[model samples]
Target: MAKGSRADHSARLAAFSAGIRATRGGKSLDINATKLLVAITQADDADRLADELVAKGFRLTRLKTHGGFLRRENAAALIATTEDRLPAALAIIRQTCRARTVTWVPPFPDGIGGIGPAPMEIEVGGAVVFTIPIEGVELLGGDVAESLARTRAAGGAQ
Candidate 1:
């Protein structure tokens, strides 16, 4: 019986792997992203990616509050766009993320309340775990071309 069970599990794993490969090679137009632990100082900052995206003539649709990380005030979710624009959107996210940092707050002992004890690290740094094929987005605009153009124009003829 145990040997039979093992064979069954192995078959299931093989089937799952085959399915993933098939999906990748198939012609199903699906664009999605799964970014975890994205730190946005302010909710509005999420739109910072607009300038670059606008230059590309891509429309951004903001999705609902997929969820939040209560412990760290971070967020995880999706923003909709044309399948081809996904890479650009991700690039914007990566650039913005570089300016932000993350720190791990170790829990306090009992009765210490919300305050965390001495944090393990002061500047651990933050990162985004991006997964393709996100559900959708709600708001748009992730380009900064106009701003860049203005800056360039202002500094011209030097």
Candidate 2:
């Protein structure tokens, strides 16, 4: 009985150690290599971007957004990837997201009787990408995409 108890204690100790290592961002986790990529894409391109990124083995979260200038539906993709994979991800984004010309009329808060607002040609339908370094990450409750940092830290795919 004593021998069995000792073995069980050892197993529990090993499990605890493994958990600690996983919590400490794993031995393979590198702060510099992990980053958060934020991409703001037009409505037409957001879904495609997310799908492509997922197909390429990237974990990302998509949020519905709106553009200030165009006042149109947009999507914000939050992607987490390693530094080595960043260039490829960026290339995918560039290839998938394209800018196009759009016509818009400015709303005149103060208007004249004869002239209201002039229609102008503007550029739209592109993605804005921002890469931010990750210090530490954890998944709360579950992977609702908040686990990117944590999963990455644990040397797992987020």
Candidate 3:
């Protein structure tokens, strides 16, 4: 092939590949718009959900959290993706983070003759998702030395 035609062929091939990938429902191609999906789920579900999201080409950060309702440890999945991929990400969350009922005992005050309230069946083990349209995002990296020092200090405190 002639030099000019070879360049043209390469450009066309790139475009064609991109089109095919887009049609195949790969990760969102739209990079201009960003969405943040904050999913607070049961700790057990969070690990699996985060893994699945990553496997599906969604970027996410997993965090250990505490929930107000139970004051129990939970997992928070912070997903940053584009609108095109939002629905698929949500479907994965819905399928993985299923809600179930658990028995919870209510804590009574000290005046209650030292007996606690009856255990009640409460809905739990589900996920709460908040979708936020992100205007912009900035990542501030931390210094390695500083992080190491902080970690050492935390360990000393512990």
Local accuracy of candidate 3 as per-residue lDDT tens digits, 107-150? 78876685678999998887889999876433234332233234
Name the regions of candidate 2 deviating beyond 4 angstroms.
1-33, 110-112, 142-158
Candidate 2 C-alpha lDDT tens digits along 1-158: 26446444333223222211123323222232377899999989987888888798676889999767778899999887777889989998999999999888988776556676889999898788999986664433532232334444454422
By lDDT: ranked, best first: 2, 3, 1
Across residues 101-149, which tens digit of lDDT does each residue of candidate 1 receive?
3465655688667756665534422335445454432222332223222
What C-alpha lDDT, on a 0 to 100 scale, does residue 4 get in candidate 3?
Answer: 50
What's model 1's TM-score? Answer: 0.37
Q: How many residue pairs clash (N, CA or C atoms closer than 3 angstroms) in each of the candidate models, in the order given?
A: 25, 1, 0
**What is the lDDT, from 0 to 100, of the residue 42 in candidate 3?**
89
Worst 10 residues of 2 by lDDT: 13-22
**TM-score between candidate 3 and the true structure:** 0.66
lDDT top scorer: 2
TM-scores, one per candidate = 0.37, 0.66, 0.66
